[model samples]
Target: MVESILGYSPVLRHCFRNVSGKQFPRFQVIKAQAMELAKEPGLCKEKERYRDSLVGLKPGSWPPKNRADNPSLYNPLARQERMGCGWLGAIFEWEGVLKEDHPDLEKQSWLALAEEEGRSPPPGFVVKRIACMKNEQAISEVLCWSRDSSQLKRMALRKEDIHQALQGGVYRFRDGSREFVNVLTRHKIPVALVSTRPRKNLEEAIGAIGIEGVFSVVVTGDDVYRGKPDPEMFVYAAQLLQFIPERCIVFGNSNLTIEAAHDAKMKCVAVASKHPVYELTAADLVVRRLDELSVVDLKNLADIELTEFGSTPELEMDVEEEEDDRRPPSSAAIGDGFW
Candidate 1:
């Protein structure tokens, strides 16, 4: 009410006075009601709904197991704890774990692509950063190349062509890769091959390497949109093998593979192919060669030792009070700097 108008009417002034203040009982009650309603889950600002959207299957996919409709492969044993190759799977990486890896060829491929596309050549660290990424993913995400699907496809193909022409069509297994694969086969363990290579290229390489029938399942870059350090490849490989990630072991050659495998809820054995064994300490087990591992080793790795609290707790102390360097490598350290 205006002061001049309120002076003329005392009753009207008294009623309208202090109406904008929160001293009223009804105003306090309304404030309390709003505070209570804000506590509702939908109104909560902090809590996130990541579990249902991330766990098990993708958003709209069906349940992984349909035991009622589909017959199960391995019958459940009556033991308290199960142990055997009957249900375990071995997932191997192609370029490094099975066949020897040549980091030079990889770097060279990128350099050749850069030269052909008139882009600046990626430095050594940049090359290392994208070592585990698929060609198109590296082109778009890391190298800042054209995001157009057609251009990415063309450049990725051209890079592969350069790599193939430089490396030739030869496929040689690393020192003990064949022996380790045979051991798994003899034990009747299903083997899976996962790689960033395209399906056709990987199939041709397997054929050339004389191990066309070895892999029970092969997951290539074509099967997934992204590559390491995303867990999609390993997770999808586990699914294709009809085995839980816990029952599968991933054998890879770098910290990226170890990170991806762990994210997929699988144990990983890092092979010291292009990387040194000491540098791969993040893996469940690091071996100079695949043959260095035995059936018992794999079994122990597959059966993760969990604590009463569900997860294995980190130790309060480091190895003999030494610096803790066993942490996994991070790809994010490369930032968004262009090559």
Candidate 2:
């Protein structure tokens, strides 16, 4: 069914057949497609407006009071400002490493795959199961569908293309990434780079951006058994920096990273550089640009108590229910021989 819908080859489908039963149960193929659809600009804006309306309503008020009477009732920006005060450490994802790099690489890659498969790609998502796979796995899957073995042989013969793509790719520092790093450094805050890219590629990109020494610690895809939405990478990074997860704040451009941070008991600030703001509602706060956030906001985030504001009941309930449905059965429920 998935292959027919997504135009995935039998070999590619086989690779993901057991993914849902793995450690990362959230990495299901169908869910990735659903997520892609939910991120459509129109749907995203509608959801945001709904959330904003809820935020404007009086807390715990039934039947919801009139907005005209409760004009001073809610301040969403103030809530975000308070949440920002509690951030002690920051974890940056590598999407922020290069500002002007191939913004549509995923789209292009998927289009290339579609061409190889001799079918039109599905709409609403850049890639099918490719987004859920690790960097190495995604590459292998693409190679498997190529027209001939020479494609692999050619890749072996010209390894420099890989290096050149990594080192000489069209990329630059994001609008205020350099300034943000400088501010963090001056304040003596610990900053770590947690990226899904391989260590060598990450190093080359960092070097290309000329921010080599900015990060105190770097965690790459090669260093982790599981990737984003697993919490392992972010947790490991926190441990390496000698800070508890709660003391760390993650800056990410994807829902996966935000979910991972929340799972690790860390606060996340969604950077809407690549994704829309509504798509990042799982994050503690969302900002249009990195420069929009300041040192004051960071300091404020570190001090605020999240429980005081209370959760967005409707959204939180939905997220919790979804997580519960995805959670694997407990070991005790399966008995001693389950493993």
Candidate 3:
């Protein structure tokens, strides 16, 4: 209603000025201010002379009754003083990003499962392929195990048991992980954790690590039908965090994680824990430790704006130019990007 009289762009720009240099404002603040500004005369002849239903209501009493027909006026990007400056969420991977799993433990678990089932041992490549997959998903999809739900459940539970025995029930944080988590919490950014591990095991591990209340959302294998390389877990995490998929930054340590994050339309920061820096070229940013990054780095990663075509306008233009020139464009054509 307010936008109909005073142009939307102009009114929201005014709201941005009023809320500048502070955290993003609630929709009510912008709506209330826009409605108040619309009431003054000389603003495009007061179209319809029909004030917003919200006008003249007490400041404390918001959301006039019977607003079923009213359209939503909230725009997350518009509320930002700048791109990525508003409320953003963080999603973290469990094994490689936050805690370091022992070398060969993953492969050993698969081998043990195969032996218990009287099957051939899985190769190293197979282990890596299923690194981010839930046990049942990997067993049925990659390993050609029986798809019966009861058998899948029994096999998945046994695999976790073998993994637990190999892991010795120990948990350890990666270098600088705990401190970085604390910094995000102190800055009021919501954090989420995603993993293919069972929720009961993950929650127990988190409790043992002494960071019980740190993560605002936790997504585990039990919560999803599939795992990484599918984007289901990351998407669910963003939904629970109440942030748009584009507003979430995923912290992970493998190419699989990077693939899943990009599939979910989220920015990814690859932690080069096991992989070398050159191998993680697909990530938006690569760092050796979590503390090496600050909030500014996260904001920069999420600063990208997408066109209706689902990619940045500059990228879209480059693709058009590539088609016009009948050749692949140089990497620098997009940006002087390291990845």
Candidate 4:
């Protein structure tokens, strides 16, 4: 009876029979099926409402104001086009690097640095601190623990050991990132991996994820004098890919990366896997999962002319501020200019 109702294999049926509560299992399965069936009407109504809302809007002006916050606004049927150049930011948390290693040590290091400076760490420091740590400036400014004592060297050694261990371990791809990359490859879009991790560690993580050759270009923290919240990495990536900054679409999960993309005058899609949707408001578009973003969306974004959104005071301010903060350090202190 179970096999006929649910089409379970004989092996599954045998296992179900071995269970003492057969009736409860059968009832639960039937209830779940019934509930799913009952949801169809509501689902259809929601979809119809979404479609109706798009009726009079301009083409490609989807995600109506009412549905802006709804992640289900992803239109699978939306048109797809061949994108010129694509820049993919490595989803660090999804790669299992954060899970396998402790970010706490790095956080502690930053806090210690803050203590030495006799100042409280700024709010949202960790968001940029982790990325900054990859740059030599961070080591010189925030992590000058060596000057204090040998204890700092031991801490640094322990951190190095953790990173080494991460290189040997495997990294799990985010739920839909692999499929998303496959789609981009199939469309022949040139995608580059821009990351805040050091090149060696970034390469190792990419290799562990089994996508070593997926990206045409890989830019790491070691490649740039500055890190996130700075457009240097993204601009350098655009240069390496031979893409105009405005034509490239950046997909990132952090506020700093999104800001970097905007500063570079590139369209950015914020993946809210790491941060909340509200926090990612700076992005051109926000989605709860990578799976929600499709090739169609990329094409639409790529075709958008920057002039459509006239320059705003806030945007101008952001760009100006970035430029102000990006002054070239002395050659003796930090080498050449950023990028």
Candidate 5:
């Protein structure tokens, strides 16, 4: 019995690790719930109106009820003030009214709503609060974007042209890429790039590398409802690749990108393209260069293994994997003369 438990110690460690983290399961669950509520078909107009009202209004003059019915009497400037600087009480009360009046929102997931907003769900909701324990580490991650490859930088192509070029022989192969793409192709696991740059830049960069065919998907900010740190972009990438967020591995150097991956429930590898390894402490795994990592280095992140009684394996993998993958490759090994 002792050996059995000891053998499964890593799974226990994984749970404890998440529990010890500041955001843990609560924030994740809530955000998901809120998105569910937002997708209600009947509540579309009400949600849109609520969002509009909050978008440009100031702090002190928010509407207490639906402004559409009594537009003539509504104080637009005062409303703006309220939105800009309203106390939490006022904001909560008004938002409550907005939700209450929206018939579509009547059946919406309140627990999800509260969680996305990082607040407690109101009374009458079914969600049990994921309690915040003391001394939890803050959940933060990076959202990095690589600089445009040299060819794209020189051409200054338009976004549409970039996308068009990507499908054909538009991009040409050159330096710096042999290391990143060659190794991944050798392993048979598809490698994709997620970027916040314009489509044109991405297309040119891919073409320059001459390995555009290697990727199963390339997700950019234009394809998402929101940019990095919001989770939409990463989620879209996972969908396009026919991969679950948990099964995906992200390589990035930005705080926003890292946070976005974390929010999507994906494992992230931080690459030190522009920043030093020490600055990338928030990443789950930090790599100084891309060459040091291979397919086997990411085994722990392949899938979520469940224990018999219900537990996930601890992420006992060493930080060395992260360190190795982050380093730029040697020139002769991968053909990346740019490095």
Candidate 6:
């Protein structure tokens, strides 16, 4: 039944909004109200009418029942299937690297590259995979451990081969990313990409698309002292924007990224660009595509609306490009040099 609904509209995936009521799960206030109304039919026509008032509830969608729904194949639970088998998988599947030559790519992509080379990964890539709980718990744990001096020390002291493995070329972006970045920039919300991808590929991709200037900041794996599910990247991004962490909103397609934003106290909006819905439960809101979001719509997002920017640019584009050491910017350069 859930699959049938998902087939029709996969974007309206799952709910994560906190609801209140002694009786209903958080965010199901209207259902609780409807039950009361059911006992007083004279006051309301039906439970459906009362249920419509709840926040984040779709108008006509029925809530899933745990007993009736299969949890194993649930969208969120099954999202692991969509992670594309990590960087190595993407390299082999695409028959090529995802990036162009870049000077500042993070050292991490070397792991993916070495795997592609069929050579033994450096000892750093062989770092022990710590036992992790499910997404939500892992997020909290990553944050807690990142703050430890011991963990940081261990990460910094990787074998020399591992450090050598971190170097690599970067990804080249297609025109689609440029258009998307343009849309984001025109909305007057300074755009920034918070990615777990190594900085090298991100730099290459942004340069290829020609829109690197659109984003005021790019928080890559190297930018943060720790990666997701640690909040370091999110917090670093917030700091770069000079915005309060709570005032920032993040869009991520992964559980780790969503958890990072949550841990940082930033508003998190998850997109189903890759993972399924259930995997994104940690986010405050979920959408199937980021193109659905508009600057005007963002203004209405109370949890993440733009209250102010110190000197944010208004919606306008000036066409131009500039030279740089890394990958070329992805979108049309902002002519005003606002960046």
Off by over 4 Å in 6: 1-178, 196-201, 302-339
**Predictions ranked by TM-score, top down?**
3, 1, 2, 4, 6, 5
The lDDT per prediction is 0.76, 0.63, 0.78, 0.58, 0.45, 0.44
Shift of residue 248 alpha carbon in model 5, Å: 0.4
Q: Residue 245: error of model 2 in Å?
A: 0.5
Query: What TM-score goes with each of the models?
Result: 0.68, 0.54, 0.68, 0.53, 0.40, 0.41
Model 6 scores a C-alpha lDDT of 0.44
RMSD of 1: 21.2
Residue-wise lDDT of candidate 1 within 8-95, one digit each (tens)?
3233222222457634443334335445654574333212333443455555552223221224325446122233433568999898
Kindly give the number of clashing pairs for every candidate. Answer: 0, 11, 0, 0, 41, 20
Ranking by lDDT: 3, 1, 2, 4, 5, 6
Q: List the residue pairs that clash in candidate 4.
A: none
Clashes of 4: 0
Specify the poorest-scoring 10-residue window by lDDT in model 1. Answer: 1-10
**Candidate 3: residue pairs that collide:** none
Q: Which stretches of candidate 3 lie over 4 Å from their true place?
A: 1-84, 304-339
Q: Model 3, range 1-339, lDDT digits (tens) per residue? A: 323322234224432324357644334454575466545543333322325544666776632232111124366444443233556899999998899866599899899999999988988989988988899989999998788999999999999889888888789999999889988988888999998989888998898788898889999999999887889999999999867777789998889889989999889999999899999999999999999999898877765464412323335656864575655444342232411
RMSD of each: 21.2, 26.3, 15.9, 26.9, 31.0, 25.2
Higher-TM-score candidate among 1 and 6? 1
lDDT per residue (tens digit) for residues 173-201 in model 5: 22233565566666556555665445655
Q: How close is candidate 4 to the true structure, as a TM-score?
A: 0.53
